[model samples]
Target: MTEEAEEELAEAIQLAQGLEVRGVNLANEGKLNGAMEEFRTALKGLEKFKRRTKLIRARIHYFIGNLHTLQGDLPKGLQEWQKAVRLDASLTDARMNVIKSLSDQGKHAEALRHAQLANSQPSPRVEILVMEGDECKALRNFTCAKLAYARALQANPRSFTAHFQLAVAHRDLMEDVPALHHFERAAEIDPTSSSVVNALAVVRGDTCQWGDPDFSENSPTNLLSVFATRDIHDKASPIHPLLLAYHLDNATLLRVVVDSQAREAARDAAVSVGHAAIQQHTNRPDPHARPRKMFSYKNTFSAFW
Candidate 1:
């Protein structure tokens, strides 16, 4: 493209971005129809620019997809996201959304195909690789999942999700030593993450490495102490339930198991209560009431990039 053409494309993209911001604000204000109109208007304006506006067009489609899902039209939402990636192969967020939606709908093979398409992009995102690993895991292709996660780690060494999931992939393949190493790294990276702490503790206990002086230099010698010191009533779910049955005595294990069950039951009860409240509010709309976070879709969609 000529310099003038490049400048025109940039100007067009800037206009579309402004429209996207307006659309997002309207959506946040619970004006779904207005948001949809703003997005469609942006799409119509971009149509004339053709290939130059491909990325922005894809983004607009992705936003439209989110709006569709917000309006409880999931199938239509999926179609919009699919249209997005077809417009621009490098639209990472749109492709990731497609991969996740397909995987959630139990279309693992299709998700894998989209993930592989990311390889064609100049620099596929680390999150895409992680999701690729996830799809592989769903398909019972642990080796493939491991490879994807390893690539993700190579791209971002400190990604807690990659390390944790890589550990899990290793565990699935019965590679205890590598799993232990990754789990330790994951725990170190995010000590407050209860799931990682639990996984690390369980692996150490199972491998008879608790308090072993030869633990990794990055890991604490008394790693199990961290798990032991955590609050007994932590709300986060355990990543591995097998931790309950691992190294504790029968009585202590029984008490811990009962507490965990109680916590889960309480959580479920709270969710039910919240759902009931939401339903009641929906049934009686208050025109004067300000919008609150009834759901997190707005935040989630913004964070896609």
Candidate 2:
């Protein structure tokens, strides 16, 4: 090659390198738009240098794909990744990115195909299984979801998300007991998760007691007394203690306080029984020993309104 041609090629290579460096910096800073610009600039700079390094071309396409994916342009992103794969079929990052993007777009069948392709590559990662599980879940293919989740759990038993999602799939299939077990396992893995706690509470029954220490003055009758004062607004139906506390805390009874046919009678009965229950509990000396309070009024009145 002539000295001029060699020097021009070297300068083009340097410009491409500079563009890639700036693009990476932009991407790390969450500047997807700026990063995409830089990547395009790099590609343009390298276009004249057809004999440039294969590694450089692969990296450029991969980065551009990544930026496109981050920008929520999945089609464009996948196209770039496909290009990168063509250049370097062994690029696990590109393959995984394509699969993830496809999955995120709710293209489960396509994603599964891509996932299968990725798994066929050497030393596939556990994340591929997780991705397949997620796609299966989205597609409502519980059997497949369960299989994928099981594989993921086998690969890494400590995967809390996998356990949680498996529980969700089971729950969707009405496998409550198994769902409960997996949910509990997930909670054990991450105790502070409110989602797990709430799910457990709902599936087991909201009234189910969790620990010791009764807060009511009365003896154990049901989970209702654990949180509130139980009393009867009417001779027919008894109100729950927790429901009463909820109404009191909200400064509104279940019965309509105004503008209804049964308003006056309901309010009078609620106040009478609620006041009596409060007095009975207050007269007790051991406040901590008292069961949690409850509303004694039937929820029927609230349900009507």
Candidate 3:
């Protein structure tokens, strides 16, 4: 813009900086209302340089938002944080507030929209991608969910949540090969997680590949009961009989899994016991649809658990 406009912006930055520093001092001295007033005054100047001074602009909004919350104005505080994120998508803290607000309101789609924006920005973050993946999975959009998790893993392969979610997404999509691979990786990284170990056991039983020593600690009662109590549903989703067999009794496993129809011999018995555990913990129950014919677990050994 013109030199006059540029000079105004520079002066505004100086004014906002002075207010921000003084506000922090007031806040520390137990003068919250005074600090909030200072913060509110700072916003007027920062608003003038919102485009060029993204970091400064966002910081002012964040400060104002914090002061508003300190004054017990949660809704107004959230509004200011929302504005901060809109100006600078890289502001993860501000984005988190917006996401949490949306989620608490049961606005899954809206949360996913902002989460996707956060992931698409520079230095794509793992946490936001996981949130996007979770939101997509909740909506039964497995394809997008897996893609989000995949991007997260691409950004950081050691992310246990990414591996777990990716495995679940692939399992939901009936893509057994990739599902099995990710599940194995997740189990390796977190052997202490019952969900991960239980899911691994189900997959091993399905493919008759029970060689891992890590899968040996789980009790048979815990593992078999999960699979034994459930049967093929009248719905369209596929729940491998092997996964249900672990929860059931001997007779139940014998009856529920075995059938006149031949079962999945395709080393792809991508199990979901592990997935179910995660879902239950996260309060996102699996939406099992399109039932597939499943046969009994032929390799149900006693020590396998």
- Global lDDT of model 2: 0.60
lDDT of 2 at 234: 29
Query: For model 1, where is the 10-residue window of minimal lDDT?
Result: 290-299
Question: Of the pair 2 and 3, which is ahead by TM-score?
Answer: 3
lDDT of 1 by residue, 1-305 (tens): 78997787778778888988899899888899999999998888777687677777888899899889889887898899999999988878778878877877899999999998995577678888988898898899999999999999988999988898899898888787898899878867776666664576456546655442433433442343345345656545632333322233333433454455456664443333233334332322122221111100011332433
Q: Each model's TM-score, in the order given? A: 0.71, 0.56, 0.59
Every model's Cα RMSD, please? 13.7, 13.4, 13.2
Give lDDT tens digits, candidate 2, residues 182-277: 866876676544355345544443323233333443422123322223232222322322233213322233332111213334454444434534
For candidate 3, report its TM-score: 0.59
TM-score of 2: 0.56
Best by TM-score: 1
Which candidate would rank higher by lDDT, 2 or 3?
Answer: 3
List the global CA lDDT of all models: 0.69, 0.60, 0.64
- Model 2, residue 48: what's the lDDT? 76
Query: What is the Å distance of residue 229 in model 2 from its true position?
Result: 21
In angstroms, the error of model 2 at 292 is 25
